[model samples]
Target: MSSVDICEKHRQQSTKTSFISFAFPYSHLRPCAHRCKQYVVGRSYLLQLQPKNRRNSHFSYSCEACQTEARSTSTENNISTHALSFTERLWKTYTNTATLLTNLFPLWTLLVAVLALRRPTTFTWLSTPYFTFTLSILMLSMGITLSPRDFKRIWKRPGIVILQFCSCYFLVPFLAYVLGRLFKLPSDILAGLVLVGSVNGGQASNLCTYIAKGNVALSVIMTTATTLGAIVMTPLLSKFVLGTVVQVDALGIAWSTIQVVLIPIALGMALNRYFKSFVDIILPISPVVGVIATCLVVGSAVAQCNKLILSAGISLQIPIFLLHLIGGICGYFLPYLLGYNEVVCRTVAIETAMKSSAFGFVLACLHFTAYRVRVPCAISVVWMSLVGSGLAVFWRYKPVQNLKGFRSDLAQRLRQKRQLDEMK
Candidate 1:
């Protein structure tokens, strides 16, 4: 019926006779007419057996067809095994390296920022054009991670999206204004603080969201939406907030946003959709590359403003730190008050707190003349990154819980129902 069945049947017959002799020619490749047993030992078939009574007890047979087939099968198997092992080894190496790089992100950014501040010349080589290119690459990496399915989630939950947008635009900007006024900051510093607040969410917020076990898809959508809106919102908010103090060039900032941020993201999405196989291989490394690009952008900014920073006192640090802290706290509490779950709250909070400070630094250098104008944004990159990373690390080990209002609201409803029953 089958080779295995035939081999099993012959194996039983072989056990009956201690020895049997059967022989066949190598060329004929056909079974001999004489009745004989056939069995398989290992990979090759055993075609003959001799009776114990015979002088020569060992049976022998030759068939070039069976031997050739066995040899060919074994050779192919060896090659396939080697190929599979090599591929698996390569994949493991890639994933291990990528994971290492992703985990070391906080260290990477902090180290680059400290080094850049200490030795400005080391990072000054990242000029304006190279800086913009690097940002585009970072944006492109972010884009490749997204898909059409991710965008559909945005439409599915418009309320969450709108709430995050409001927090990004209104809450952060207003917080910056209040902090600036309370600190009694100079005109340039105030303008820079407001400008940083008005810019879109930074790319690093996605990493923080992932670390915190927040809604990563929501974080990506929020970043994408805010960045697209920044073309108009950043300039308008800056002009409205800072116009009294400085001559704001709204047009220039809009053009820069379009050129640097939007196009790269679009290109990356197109490439991911079209060249999925290639992207899969590159995707693991993209985050690490993005981290390096971000470091370069921050380092360049620090290098540019090294002198102003060394001379400035603690007065400058307080406002920037407060801006991020206030924004983060407000972002969480407002959403929690509105009855959102903890995941959404965490996502919104991170997006609100981590502004595109690099974009702010670039705009400041382009539009503002005062050294103080660039100082807040330059320092913002360091403090916001540290604060966000700390929150992410804390959240990673902890479980997310529902807002306090969830229990309070349930109790209030129970009370109202009891009162209605008593009245009836």
Candidate 2:
């Protein structure tokens, strides 16, 4: 039997013994009187009481106090155990399914798009209002997960957080713009790529940094700061880069950013603060909502792939996608070489590389009719999930080599231990 069953059995036995002891007065009970009489007659009949009878008698017996106690304990145990098991199962399912989907989603989206090319009308449903709603829901879920503690930590370590955000908002976007210009990508795709690069770090960056044993607080702050900055930066950079190719209104893009990004986050923060108990109650199930929203968004993007491929063409997408992958790698590691610690480096790298493609895609749909504008963002979404997850796993299990600085820290810790031992 499972440990739970074993524990339940023991609990029931204990409860039965307690109830039996409480129910009968030992001095006045017939069994006790007879046992005493037998003892006086120099016989041991007490041992001859049937064990089966003792066990069965307790089950048939019920006392008001004992019953109440037993019922309360059982109910509490059942609820706690059930809740724990459900959480464990949900986490297992999310990680496993996310890994699977991340690996296969891009290829699946591309293949389905190619197959459905001849019957374009079949996939037309991807452009419906439901798809946009799913995107909005995904953003809301992401916003709720952003802890305020992240910002507090940034106040403590402003330099590191600022450096990380600079890498994300300034360095990465400029690199992507330069690469896009050099490659001479099509107008819509180039605008999309620049927009993707111009946006802030994704929500997944915090998850990745946490897994990597990095400064997750810094990552969260950087994400929040950069996201706020994106309201102005994304539109301005997009206009500058895509001005010759296509018209983009910077003020309009800023308003869209405020509508989609700022409003939801502010509302979520307020709700979380004012209804802290309610948020705590729902926090366990928040991941479920996030996973469902993510799936819907991906499915919507995939369903729109035919239009994207038709308008942008495979050749343009292939090179730009490759460029994006390379840019992400460069963005991730550059901070490390610039004297930041591994944790800061990992955070910066992830933040710089992983764009908030959901934001980009939503903005694209709002601003442009061309489905091709979402192609780079869609592809990046899948690519970064796969790459970021792998990096997270790697850092989680990666052996810690005692470099000079780490060894010095370890030495200081050992010295403190020795001093404490001496004091003891």
Candidate 3:
């Protein structure tokens, strides 16, 4: 045990005649508040003396660990008086900047979209390969943030997960299809809109949920579930929705989804499970990296679709905007109508609206080469980002409460004001 415990045990075992002695260094005493205080004079035989009982003979004991602890504490106190190293200060600054950018994800998306539109050629360099790498990194970042606790949440609240999947996969895709037909969009635009809806939940939705103070664990689980399901669902749903208009390579898109979404996320989860320490170091800056990667992906897609956007004008942008707007509103209200909490409503809304625009863009580019399928996905990256982030910011500032509660709170405030006026 410890030195104190050892001394106490010795005292418990000793007779009245027995005594214990401890010898401590002079230099360690001044710096260590917990250690002995008495000092010896003029090179005395002992530094300090404490005896439980008087005896002719006594034994001395010293604890190396206690001495080492005292010396280390003194060193730490001394070091606190000095300035931090350049590298340490630099890391602190870097983390602060990264955290700030990470929190303002929507702003980053908007900036990237505007920049991409203004200078398409500048961001055209972020090609297909770079897009995949960026998305893979983003998914990896998401995976590292997950834990067993997140998975255990499934059993705890299976209904929320089920409702989210229904909203994300079924309700959203149906709305997209209906909107495409209602708008009487062209074949290419219709296909693009449907494909966007058929894809997995947005990469940034979980982050937005966290920012909004919603159910982050639920968000993560829903994203992961939807992403994993996308391998089968995305291609099948796209084919079902777009088959009559154009020939869709469902198999090709499925394999792409596997490569783009499933594998990277799985790899990330594994790393988090097996290599947590490495993941811990990477976690601090991973969100910013993901956001930067998202900006590049969205920007590059927008750049590539610049001509299409300018020529199509509102015809293309309107459908994409409507799709996300409808998705976000329906996702929230549907869950709320079902009597779920405000947190679940917010989480589902974000999840439903924020489809994987990058994944859709990649699929459109790879499968529907002749058409401007990527245009809708690119536009969606900007639109849904603005919508989702705006909603999140609103929820962040406004506390979610029912109308009855609000009315009650307002009445209470009015009563308090009346009391204060009477007192005055």
Better of 2 and 3 by lDDT: 3
Best by TM-score: 1
Candidate 3 clashes between residue pairs 3 or more apart in a chain or in different chains: none
* Alpha carbon lDDT of each predicted model: 0.79, 0.63, 0.77
List model 1 lDDT by residue over 250-323, tens digit each.
Answer: 88888888877788878888889999999998987897798788888999988888888777768888888888
Candidate 2: list runs displaced more than 4 Å: 1-129, 146-149, 310-314, 369-371, 394-397, 402-424
- lDDT at position 413, candidate 3: 85
State model 3's lDDT: 0.77
Which ten contiguous residues of candidate 1 have the minimum total lDDT?
17-26
Location of the lowest summed lDDT over 10 successive residues in candidate 2: 36-45
Please give the TM-score that candidate 1 achieves against the real structure.
0.81
What RMSD does each model have against the real structure?
A: 7.4, 10.7, 8.8
Q: Rank the candidates by TM-score, best first.
A: 1, 3, 2
Measured by lDDT, the strongest candidate is 1
